[model samples]
Target: MEQKIFDCAIIGGGLAGLTLAIQLADSGCTVILFEKESYPFHKVCGEYISMESYSFLERIGIPLSSMHIPMITEVLVSSVNGNSLTRKLDMGGFGIRRYTLDAAMAKLAVQKGVTLLEQTKVTDIKREGDLFQIKTAQGNFSSKLACGAFGKSSVLERPLGRLTAKSAGEKNYVGVKYHVKTDLPDNRIELHNFNDGYCGISKVDGDVYCLCYLTGSENLSRSGNSIKTMERNILMQNPFLQRYFTHSHFLYDEPLTISQVTFKRKSQVANGILILGDAAGSIAPLCGNGMSLAMHASFIAAPLILDFLKGRLTHQELCMIYEKQWKEHFSKRIKTGERIQHLFGKNILTNAAIGTLKLFPKLADALISMTHGKPF
Candidate 1:
């Protein structure tokens, strides 16, 4: 078979990959995207996105105003013992499931003339001269540029030497998600802390609530690897969590889970492949703005990529600009999230922090601002 070379080859059809593909294709770049999973699938995410990317998504054809998803404007945080604080979000967000959001983006990418290869896994990528050779289950393909938007973990990372020795020990957390019928307020999102992790609850589309939590893997092993047991013994200790878990009707037959979640630092550009989203770096879920950050990264990367493809910028120049802009926008936020994570999951510290935030609303606002960014 004759090899077809694309202008850009994107791996992982998540928010970052799909959005970037659409932007480049709109600019008349020949784009091809590969996703191991089919469209309209669920992912272990909090399902809430910060409002900073609202305009960007609309520009890319996602009609947020028409979606009727809940607009979350207030935050309610609680400690392990159920002590709570409520704060108004200056720049609020909305909730939509990954199944809905990603599927919509995929459909739009197809409509915009992108060669989207769904259910195709990219096994390897190698750079030869100025082009990238991508090997996949389907066949060999080539592109002027390759992007790694694969979320969190992938086999490709090992071959690319993107992982350090510390990475092997870094994957210590487990994330679990479920959609449930609940009576949570539509205009508010809540974070409830537990022994070794935290849970976020918000109203997504279809009048259902997204209930997702991240916990230390040790917590699961201590409970014999049973999610229910961990929830009962550790999560239930929080009064708010106990009430929700006891009352809400879980929509899933079994909760969706992903293990080995880590917040370790990652390189944005590796082996001549431009990395985006979780593949680049993931913030602690406590921040509640990771989805926005992922989309924002694509927003920042697309222009530089277009310049590189147009010969207006060299690959080195493109990488330098993208790395600088990405760090300028996200590095501090990720670090702040890591610091904030330290304040949760413990009985005394969480309660104290909640109490302090409640007493000093300005401090809470400052902390929230630190983890979020201005509109792009």
Candidate 2:
């Protein structure tokens, strides 16, 4: 038997990895993508994407226009105290279930000749001379270049030296998600804040809605580690959330949950491997633009990876340029999201902020524009 090397090997099959794999395959590169989970799976996400990514997804073969997805052009924000406001959105987005979108992208990637390994876990990756030694559950493989799209938390973080002892114990955030049938407007997205957490609900494809939230881990501890208790005591305090909880029809037996989600800065280049998406730097979910950020990182990386494989750019140049570009585009956005998250989820401050923004609509527009970017 002969061992063959591919042009690129991507470790995760999220939006970043799938999009990058398809782009590289379209350019005639032998690309391999690994996804531990099978296709058409659910992720703990807001499932709302900014318009900045609409054209990009369309260009990449996602049939958003034909999917008849919900278009959101207005926002309804409520404080923990139930002080609420509704305002028009300047750069609205569309909603689609992650499984539907991800599965569509995976199909396109396969059609473009990308070898997608579903249910294949990558145990380790090492650099051997000029090639990357990729050891997975299936077998050992080699590639000219490797990518890390492993989302927010992964064992690979330690091996890549991206996690440290002190940071490991640092307080982490938890995310919860559900699909439901609600009477909320299909053209509007609502965000309701609670102590140490906030929830966002919007219309997705078909008649279902995506209801997702993020909170500090300590909140769960304070509630006896019970999601139902936390939701009833904390989240229901907001009249808006209470209405939805009492009236909506939940479609799942148990909500999808993920923990150890941190928004701290991450290395763009680690162990000589390129990092993209949430694994690189996750924006606060309040920003409602994380999907776009992840896809944009893939958009930024495809060409650079292509250049390196073609020998047009040296490895040092590729790493340096990618880091610079990644920071230039996303650093400020993440910082802004952090600041916004800080101001929300606190009763007094969030109520005052929402009250003020309601009186001054332009101020709300400016705040939104800060966390989002112009179309790529």
Candidate 3:
């Protein structure tokens, strides 16, 4: 029997990989996707996407009618000292959870004729002339071009060889989130400040509210077998948070956490593999724009790769183009996110900043724009 050769191989079936695969399939290109996990997996994310993603979703023939995600029109910033500011956000953003979004994209990819290999992990990858030989747990495959859409750190980064310095920030950071049934305002996304971190609350599909927060890992280490203990001890420092936690009933069994998410920069491409999504670069968790940026990058990368496959662009040219495009579109935004990460990590600074912003409405709007603008 003869093996099939794909024009492009996509390793990772997250939103970025699925988006690129759907676009290429519609453009009549052969793409093979390898996913390590099954569908509808939960990821530690803010779960908000800016309006920039709508155009790309439309192009892929996905009507978001089923996604009852709310539109957040305003941002309210509050300090622990009782000072607050509210701004009318310039661009509207969606608050859909990743579980719904990822499954929908996967279904659309299959409908668009993409060959998906779910739960098939890629073990090793090496170059064979101009092609990439990908060894997966299932078997082997070849493709002229390969994409690294794998989220965060993966086995793929090892062969690429230390692209970025490891983040040495306090490894005590942890993110816990839950889908809750609450009588919360659907149109507004709230960010409440706690002791060492903040919590973001928004309405998503089925009118269930998604609430997530990042806190110190040591806080949880002392808790005895309950997320509630961590929240009460570490997060209850703020009276506002204490009230919310005590008042709002949960919609799930308990909250989930992702420990020590590092945010040092990573390479866009290495050894003929193009990195996409969190694989290429990760914004700080508090930034809340990583998923939207990934979607926007996928929109741009698919067309660039299509041009390369049609012999209109060389591989070097494609790599250069992808890197240039991403940096041009996202460089400043990422820098801004990093800055915010540093500023908000300290309780005194965060409270002072929020208090200062509360006195100036226009300045508060400017700050909101810096964090959540719809550039890409």
Candidate 4:
């Protein structure tokens, strides 16, 4: 049997991989994508994409009208103490469940002539002279360039090893998201404080609400398997959350949970393989724009990978370009997210800060700006 050859081989069929596959294919590159799971699958994510991704989505020919996701133009921040502030989001973003977004992007990839291998797991990749030989569970494939769009904790990150021996406080952080049927205003995104965790609620798709939360795993375990109980006891201690948890009803029977989410600054590429999306380095989820960041990184990398394939840039040059461009454009935002995470993770400090913000509403706008970034 003949081995399949492609200009590029993409690993992990998530947003980053599928988006880049479409970019490369539209650029006239023969790309093959290997995904471990079928599309329309659930993931632990915030599912919000900034206005920054709107142009990229359009560039790839995904019509905004075809997307059933909701648009949000406001951000609401509240404290455990009933102190709250709201900001009209300077730039609007869209919300779609990962299950639907991933499927839509994959369909776009197929339409653009990119080969998508569903349920395919890539086992290994080795650089063979000028090209890469990729080994998947199915068969051997060759490509001029390879991309790791695989999300956090995948086999791809193993070889680069740990960024530091210190855990950097990530071990305590866990994330969970739920898709629920509810009637909620589509214009706002709300962050509610629960004991050690924070929950974000917003509309995604036509009628489904995506409620995502991040917290300490130990706190969750101590609650005896009741998320609502944990929220009421630990999270709602904040007067603001107490009001919502007491007044509003959850639309889901039970929520989804993701344990032990860790974040580290990452090198954009290792062993000549380009890294894309969360596989590269994930900003703190509290930063609230990861989906857009992942898509933007893909937009940046597609051209660099293409240049290497075209022999316009050497392998060393390609890595240098990707790392340099990514850090220059994104390092500050990721760092800002880390700082905010530190502030919001503590109870007493968070309350005091929220109180201060309520006193001077401008502070809340500044914080919202920190999360939204420059107008794209």
Q: Which candidate is the best by lDDT?
A: 1
Candidate 2 lDDT over 207-325, as tens digits, reads 79999999998988899999999899888998989998889999998999998787778899998899999999989999999889989999999999889988999988999999999
Q: Each candidate's lDDT (Cα)?
A: 0.92, 0.91, 0.78, 0.79
> Which wins on TM-score, candidate 1 or candidate 3?
1
lDDT of 3 by residue, 247-362 (tens): 88886786777776667677788887888888888776666778877777788898899899989999999999999998887778888887877776467887889877777767
- How many angstroms is residue 77 displaced in model 3 relative to the true structure, after the best TM-score fit? 2.2
User: Model 1: per-residue lDDT, tens digit, 1-376?
Assistant: 5778899999999999999999999999999999999999999999989999899999989998999999999999999999999999999999999999999999999999999998899999999999999999898889999999999999899878887776454548999999999888899999999998999999999899999999999999999999999999999999999999999999989999999887888999998899999999989998888888888999999989999998999999998999999999899889889888877898899989998888999999989878878888
Higher-scoring candidate on TM-score, 2 or 4: 2
Q: How many residue pairs clash in each candidate?
A: 0, 0, 1, 6
Badly placed stretches (over 4 Å) of model 4 are 160-170, 225-228, 239-253, 374-376
Each candidate's root-mean-square deviation in Å?
Answer: 1.2, 1.1, 2.0, 2.2
lDDT (Cα) of model 2: 0.91
What is the TM-score of each predicted model, taking all chains together? 0.98, 0.98, 0.93, 0.92
Task: Please give the distance, in angstroms, between residue 70's alpha carbon in candidate 4 and its true position after superposition.
Answer: 2.2
lDDT of 3: 0.78
lDDT at position 360, candidate 4: 86
